[model samples]
Target: MGTHYEGDLRVALLDAAVLALGETGVDGLSLRGVARRIGVSHAAPAHHFGDKVGLLTAVAARGFELFTEHLAEALSGGEADPVAQLPLLTRAYSEFAENYPEHFDLMFRPASVRVEDPEYMRTSGIAFEALRAHLEECQRRGWRGEADSAALTSAAWALAHGIAVLRAHGSLARHYSDPTLDAVEDIAVSLLF
Candidate 1:
């Protein structure tokens, strides 16, 4: 029998999974690895999560929740103008990536793990909804162009995703010392406008 902790093992396993994923890519993540990291037997994770994919799905869901919360907080803060808000969002994203590098990797890696699990889809949808709401606010303030709102939103997401990916890969910092999310937002906004 697997040892039980005082709190929820599922949550603990998910946390361990994120750490393992951050340290190693998705391909390197294993239930046994997470279990060992958490000081449990190899089969402990299987008790909490059926398989490796189950653990990954849980981690992905948690990642989306964290991402949504950070983005929402950024939008709520009035420290900057709309033009500046984009960069703040980008910065928040980059900060999240840096802080939770493992979650960041799993969150964006294409086809590395299945996200079809209901919990994963639901959490992912929440993140998308939060982004859409932010985009709607931008539209309300006349920050967008004649482009369709959905298209504009998609473009903004793509721009942010691209920059975040570059930043994560160390290409942006290595290639440009002055690289900042503001610089990226400026280029995106200028192109869109």
Candidate 2:
């Protein structure tokens, strides 16, 4: 008898892809492997995603959606002060990276996924705007100096991204004496802002 999969195959495939990416990293993930892991035919992933890049693009899109939700929830749990919000947002970004390293990795690697996919574009924009809105408010209130809001937003994101990437890749622990990502993240954020 042939294997059967009920529910949404697309979602199942994405979940399998995320897990496979975690195990093999991006370079080793394949449509056949993802399908095989889920007991689906080898062509299932390609049918839904067109190719490996398409599957990765879908993964990146889902990552952005989850990422945006993470940021929104973090900001909403705190006071409205933009200055106060930075640490929360920074921590949330890093936490997302730590919690979803595979998604985080694929989300930032532009060359690995389709940049023009509508879902990916929309979700990623929402994630960026979450920080952009906060930075704009900070600039308006003179809380982040006189630098342009765009530059300030990008700088803040870059700082958080750098920390997250380093931690994800295990380089932070190798180079720094800090015993925890939180401690290093706090120090980095406090130093600049």
Candidate 3:
């Protein structure tokens, strides 16, 4: 057997939770399952997470962290028009979903999981704030109107999110003969700009 090394059991539990949630979703997630997948005893996850909700809170938190990181990287290319950056970020969002299907599913699916914990809320806020910061930059650059930045950001977010949802569900393939992220982003940006 391999050597057993560990420091933060919480981190281990979170990692396992992400894998389990991604595979089976919230309804199918089990503390024992996570523990087993990590090669630990069935009781191990409960020792660190207290319960399933705690474990999911950690998973959602990590997902938001990753989402924020991806968005930030997508926006960092220093394009002259931050509005142009919108399509890039949108593509990045969809790419993240395609690459991490489970994480994407858990992050957006309403019925699959419920993360009402305050810590989860705070973590989710990080992703929202990242997007809001970009929108604020757009307003500063005169790309946006004097209207509410929050509303504008929400609209843009919805556009990207809708495209991602359709693509993930294989719905876009039905309607749009060629539903590439670049095409989706191009159409969305053209409509906005």
Q: Which candidate ranks first by TM-score, i.e. highest?
A: 2
Model 1: per-residue lDDT, tens digit, 1-193?
Answer: 3465668777888888877766887888888888887677888888767888777767777888988887878668786556557766766776677677777777765475577778778888888877777777777787764558778777777877777788878788887675665565555545555
Quick one: best lDDT, which candidate? 2
Could you give candidate 3's per-residue lDDT for residues 1-193 as a string of tens digits?
Answer: 1236376767887877877877787789998888877787777778766787667666666777788888888777677677678878888888788877766776765444456767667878888888888889888888865969899889888888888889888998898787787777776777777
Better by TM-score, candidate 3 or 2? 2
For candidate 2, the C-alpha RMSD (Å) to the true structure equals: 1.8
TM-score of 3: 0.87
lDDT assessment of candidate 2: 0.86
Ranked candidates (TM-score, high to low): 2, 3, 1
Itemize residue pairs with steric clashes in candidate 2.
Answer: none
In candidate 3, stretches whose alpha carbon ends up further than 4 angstroms from where it belongs are: 1-7, 78-80, 109-114
Supply candidate 3's per-residue lDDT for 90: 84
What are the lDDT scores of the predictions, listed in order?
0.74, 0.86, 0.77
lDDT of 2 by residue, 45-69 (tens): 9999999999999999999999988
Worst 10 residues of 1 by lDDT: 184-193
Task: Look at candidate 3 and give me any clashing residue pairs.
Answer: none
Model 3, residue 105: distance off in Å is: 2.1
Off by over 4 Å in 2: 1-4
